[model samples]
Target: MAEPAVRYFFGQDGTKLAYRDLGVGRPLVLLHGFFSSGAHQWLHSGFAHTLAADGHRVIVPDLRAHGDSAAPHGAEHYPDDVLTDDAFALIDYLKLTTYNLGGYSLGARTVVRMLVRGAAPSRVIVAGQGLREVTGKGGTVARYLRHVFSHLGTFKPGTAEWKAEQWLTRTGGDPEALLHVLDSVLDTPADALTGIEVPMLVVVGDRDDRDGSALALSRTVSQGTHVVVPGDHTTAITAPELAETARTFLRDQ
Candidate 1:
């Protein structure tokens, strides 16, 4: 199917954000990962199509500083929990009272924050993220990204930081904007996970643990289940089974 047309809305701070709406059924908002856009994470990987085809009005937003969203170089635009704020702003702009929400990687982290801050989605999908990712101090990925950005063009070819830089360059990411976004990240305390009463699906790849324990995260939630697919941190997002498993989980009553 053809990709949906991009739509625009103003965030709480007046930053213009973009999202794609497709299919037609129960509302399902899916957020993309860091250093990736909605089109790359969802559309190109066939994840959104699978969910949309399974009777969902798939809504994927490109977070601020990623994809088509405004990438302000100023630090003032990236307040603490800024991504969470943007997510809530989008939900409010759409006027969605009841909806299923899910996200991958950074997106998943944002979903957890939204829940902690009082988002009442009917169901939630947290994929490619783990407990430490949600609760750990100064996130591993955040630190790693900081290092990569801080030393861009100085790393050896085989180093992980170099690889990350190459990926960022290929994706046309804005280092300054992304660094500010990373700086705005606020860790969610472990105790806050218990307050999320809605059913939650913790989907992670068997070989992926860059952030932390996925099973541990699932166990923390009041009503959560775990599903391990085949792939690592990066490849997991493209795994076809990931989408299929998510569909089954979200479809269950």
Candidate 2:
């Protein structure tokens, strides 16, 4: 098959968003994790390719402030639920009434927000995340965000912010914008994770202490399924088991 083509669309706030399109079937939109983009979490990790070849049109977008998407560093640009709006905009732009949706880490947080907002997707995949993080217990993730914000609009070597900036440089990202993205959605109600009727999968690694326990998160939702794969938060994104598990669940549906 030919390489997928990149497409651009404007968010509700007029920020330019980027996505990659592939295959032909029901649309499955996947969002990437923090400090990562569609290319990093899905394409490079082979998750997007797997879904597309599985007979689904995989649409993976770089959330605002990440990847090729336009990044506006100010808080005004990242109002609460901005990411959620962007997700819905993509779905609406494609005129997809029913589709699959999912995200990893920060992306999973967006999925939770979308779900609570009543965004309807046939199925949802929550990867490399746990209830604790969604419930506002993101100790480590919070620290990283704090570090980034502390040095926003400037650079200090050997810090988390510095490392993230370096990575952004490599990816052509907007570090200030990404930091604002983190600050924007740092708090979500714990009750939001419960009572989701849509088929949902919560995936995390056995060794991942980043977000507490994934199994507990699954139990809270009526239709949630938990899959414990090997590796930590970072490794789970690329872990083959993660893809296979999600693919199986999606296929079963």
Would you estimate the TM-scores of all the predictions? 0.97, 0.91
lDDT of 1 at 8: 96
- Candidate 1 per-residue lDDT over residues 110-211, each given as its tens digit: 999999999999999999888878897527677778989988999999888888999999999999999999888888999989888999999998888643
Model 2, CA-based lDDT? 0.82
Model 2 ranges with Cα > 4 A deviation = 152-165
For candidate 1, what is the lDDT? Answer: 0.91
Regions of model 1 farther than 4 Å from truth? 210-212
Candidate 2: C-alpha RMSD to true structure equals 2.3
**Model 2 TM-score, all chains together:** 0.91
Provide the overall lDDT of each model, using Cα atoms, as 2-decimal numbers. 0.91, 0.82
